[model samples]
Target: MRISVLCDVKPLLGEGPVWDVRAERLWFIDSLGRRIYRCTADGAEMRAWTVPHAIGSMALRDGGGAIVALQDGFHAIDFETGELTHLVDPEPDKPNNRLNDGKVDARGRFLCGSMDTGESDPTGALWRLDPDMSLHRLDDGIICSNGPCWSPDAATLYFADSFTGEISTYDYDIATGAVADRRTFAVLPKDRGGAPDGATVDAEGYVWSACVFDGRIHRFAPDGSVDRVIEMPVCKITSLNFGGPNLETLFVTSMAEPPLPKYPGDGPQRGATFRVEGLGVTGRPEPYFAG
Candidate 1:
């Protein structure tokens, strides 16, 4: 496969990568930078907007604008006016926790997880935001939340708590937006030197995860077997998504600042977005938040 940098702009903490199938564009967030960016399939016509607080993740809305998970809570962002309207805060009492990774399910519900800012406490939890704008807490006692994705049939949900270094799978009820029977799907060995960050599933049902300090992208089969591993040039690879005209390109994101001293050799493209092509597998279009 061919891997190359998609853009020159680097972000402090590049995390979420969302592909807008209908618009043929890619949207990503610079969490620490508090910036949201949009670009075409070719990485041109790039545009950015700065928010007031650090952003965890975001999803395009079905009606218009977008829904963002900021440090404070969920907000509706209007691309035309750049106005951020407060929606709801799932963890209002836990001021130390901030929303992290999020994705829209096939049934049009937005699911996101919160993470403890200190990265030490287990105050985080997984939450679901229905199309009606109501919220529900699915799971709790998480340290660091990341990588929320679903299987091809939408019957399984995979999520990772980076601090735990384990990816868990849950039986997902698409119709009711419920998750149960959580079990270990995969784990990053302690000797691996990194944790699983963000992930996405291909159309063939293979799950792709970005290893943070390990500098690798791992593909896991449906049965939770390691299918393959693709090493990256950057050390702090954060997240990835499938974009491009046919959803054949894997757009990867990374972080540049707060360099990890243990894993050296990070070049100038550390925080720049990268794309992998010719994987011989495409991805399904990500669903937009119906709310």
Candidate 2:
């Protein structure tokens, strides 16, 4: 598939692309820039809000605002008024840990993971936040937690630890929001300098993952077989998801690596969002955080 530039903004670390069906818009973030953005389907009518803390990821809430993973903890952000309502801080003492990639499940529960800022510790953990405002720790020993998505049937869950170059799957109990039977699903090409960043599942049960430094998106079948690969123009592909009227368009987010010393701003295709049209597979609707 061919990649087309969707938005031209340069983000230090752009990630978390969420398609809002009701609003007909796409929401994403510049993590390092501490900004959250929204744009129309065609990448027009762009708007953004600058936050006080680093934003790892976010999800659209049911009524309004957003459930945001800030540097210290989770908060409800009112984009219109720039108001942040304090939520629970899962990691109160781990100053180096911050929330990373996340998504809502079919049961209306939000599942997210955290990562150590230095990318050198196994202190990160996957967490579940229920609609009743309860938090559950799912897994630990994750270094750089990144991707967290579910299968099309909601019977399995997929997550990745970018620092370890490992992607794993688990048998999920949808009713209880519990996962069991952890197995290695895919391994990123560590020698090639790419690590699995963020991922999403397609209608055909294919797991599409962005290789951060490899400049490619890998599609894996249900059995963990490589099904297809999409080449990208830039490295540091941070995250991706399906969006559009029919969920046929795949939107990708990227980050510029090793900022230039002289100019520090001159780079090609870095920190830009892209769209892959006609991907042949459709994406399921991203569930909103019901809290």
Candidate 3:
């Protein structure tokens, strides 16, 4: 499929693409730039706001505003008024850790993770924030938590520990938002290219992962078999999610990290958002955080 550059701002770290079906708009963030962006489906009327500080990811709330994973904890952000309501800080003592990639699950629970600032220590972990505002730790021992999504049926959880180059699957309990039966699902190639960063499952049950530093997104079948690959012009493919009115447009985000001597493919769109269409596939509407 062909992909086109959507926005050309070239952020320091363009990540967290979320589709707001009700608003008919797309929201994402630049973690390093400390900016939150929103735009129309066609990429016009785009606008951004400089947040108080870095925000790793965010999900639209059911009523209004957004539930965001800020550097310290989760908060409710009012973009129009630039207001923030503090929620919870899972790791207040760990000053070096910050929140990372995340999304809302089928049951409207917000799922996210935290990682070390330097990205070399195994202090990261996966967390779940229930609709009642209660927080729970799901998994730990993560170095760089990246992709965290669920299957179409909501019966399986797919998460990637980027530092380990492994994507692990778990048997999901949708009612309780609990996951078990942990097993390695997909392992990134040991080449110079980086591991999987952000991922989402499609309507047909295939997992699509953006391999950061690889300049490609890989599609894996239900049985964990690699079936397709999407080549990108930029290397730091940070995250992606299916958006647009029909949920058929695949929106991708990237980082502005310069190409390393060993890894190439850094282009003008390195930190810009992308849209991939004509794939003849559709995605389910992402559930908003009910809390």
lDDT of 3: 0.87
TM-score of each: 0.97, 0.96, 0.96
Order of all candidates by TM-score, from best down to worst?
1, 3, 2
Q: Please give, for residues 183-231, the per-residue lDDT of candidate 1 as tens digits.
A: 9999876666789999999999999999887889999998889998898
lDDT of 3 by residue, 197-287 (tens): 9999889988889999888888999888898888887878889989999999999999886423444647666798999999888877889
**Best of the candidates, lDDT:** 1
Candidate 2 lDDT over 12-62, as tens digits, reads 889999999889899999888899999987999999999888888998899
Number of clashing residue pairs in every model? 0, 0, 0
lDDT of each: 0.91, 0.88, 0.87
Stretches > 4 Å off in candidate 2: 257-266
In TM-score terms, which candidate is top? 1
